[model samples]
Target: MNVFQSLVSSWQFWAVLSALAAALTAVFAKLGVKGVPPDVATFVRTIVILVFVSSLLFVSGQFSIVRSLSRRSVGFLVLSGLATGASWICYFRALDLGKAGQVASIDKMSVVLVAIIAFLFLNERLSMLATLGVLLISAGAILVAVAD
Candidate 1:
């Protein structure tokens, strides 16, 4: 495959896109939440996401698979949705009160937290290098959060 095809098929490409989108989200949300209650901002964001994702699923012909999801999958997805909502509320509130960079740095600490949690509960193994990277990410987040 050519480089473009290889990148299109790679998880890293999607992850990089996700990171870029998240960075923009922090900036846009910080500006957008001005004068609006954080909760209301979050609600509006949720509605937009719902509409976007629903439309994407419909267009991709994937909406029908929702009915095929196992009960366990549905239950976990529900829990994940609740957790995501709570995180967004807290993140929006933080962004309202703090610098965007500071708020985003703290929010990105979830990367380290996820590594640890996955290791503990998901039977995931981290190589020494990966563990070091996680530690560095935690330290960098702390530095960024406190630098302001």
Candidate 2:
């Protein structure tokens, strides 16, 4: 396979893309919330995301599965949505008040949190090396957040 095809096929590629997009989100959101209230900015961002994702679902014919989803699936999705909304509000507010890099650094501490949470609740296994990496990520995030 060509390099581009191989790269696009890997989960690592998508994760890297997500990281880059998140980095841009911090920069763009910091700028966007300059004069606006963070909550209001979050609302606007939510609307845009809703429209964009809805359109993508519609065009991809994925909207048809909405009614086929189980009640439990819907319930968890609702909870996830609530959590996402809360996180976005807090993230935007942090961006409004702090340095983008520092805010993003702390935000990325979610990685460590997820690793622990997954191991506890999702029965995911973490080897010693992975645990050490998580510890390093936590330390790095803390150091970056506290750095002048």
Candidate 3:
């Protein structure tokens, strides 16, 4: 199989691509925010993302799913979108004033926060190893954020 077929077959491929894209986002946003306010930059980015994803949804016939979403689902999605907007604004501002690696490292502490929040709010159970993994990730994020 060619590389495209191999990547399509791997479940992990999407995560890897997401990581790469996220890294590029930081770099590009950092550059784009050089003279612009972070909030404005985020707004522009959000518009671009909205258009791109909306196009994808229409092209892939996924827009039909919207009508099936219940009020609760729509409300939760709106809340999530607001949270994402806030996160992007903060992330872009952080990138503007800090090194990308340091900013991104600190941002990743959200993973640890998510694990704890999931356990507490979602009642999601983590195995001992997963708990340890969260602890390790938390420690590493702290170390990276504080490193000279």
- The models' CA-based lDDT, in order, is 0.96, 0.95, 0.90
Q: Which residues of candidate 3, in runs, are more than 4 Å off?
A: 1-11
Residue-level lDDT tens digits of model 3 in 1-148: 9999999899899888888998898788878989899889998998999999999999999999999999999999999998998899899999889888789889988888899899899999999999899899888988888887
Best-matching candidate per TM-score:
1
Best candidate, lDDT-wise?
Answer: 1
Residue 15 accuracy (lDDT) in model 1 = 99
lDDT accuracy of residue 101 in candidate 3? 77
Q: Candidate 3 lDDT (Cα, whole model)?
A: 0.90
Supply candidate 2's per-residue lDDT for 68: 100
lDDT of 1 by residue, 1-148 (tens): 9999999999999999999999999999999999999999999999999999999999999999999999999999999999999999999999999999999999999999899899899989999999999999999999999995
Q: Estimate each model's TM-score.
A: 0.97, 0.94, 0.89
* Per-residue C-alpha lDDT of model 2 across residues 40-140, encoded as one tens digit per residue: 99999999999999999999999989999999999999999999999999999899899999999999999998998998999999999999999999999
Best-first order by TM-score:
1, 2, 3
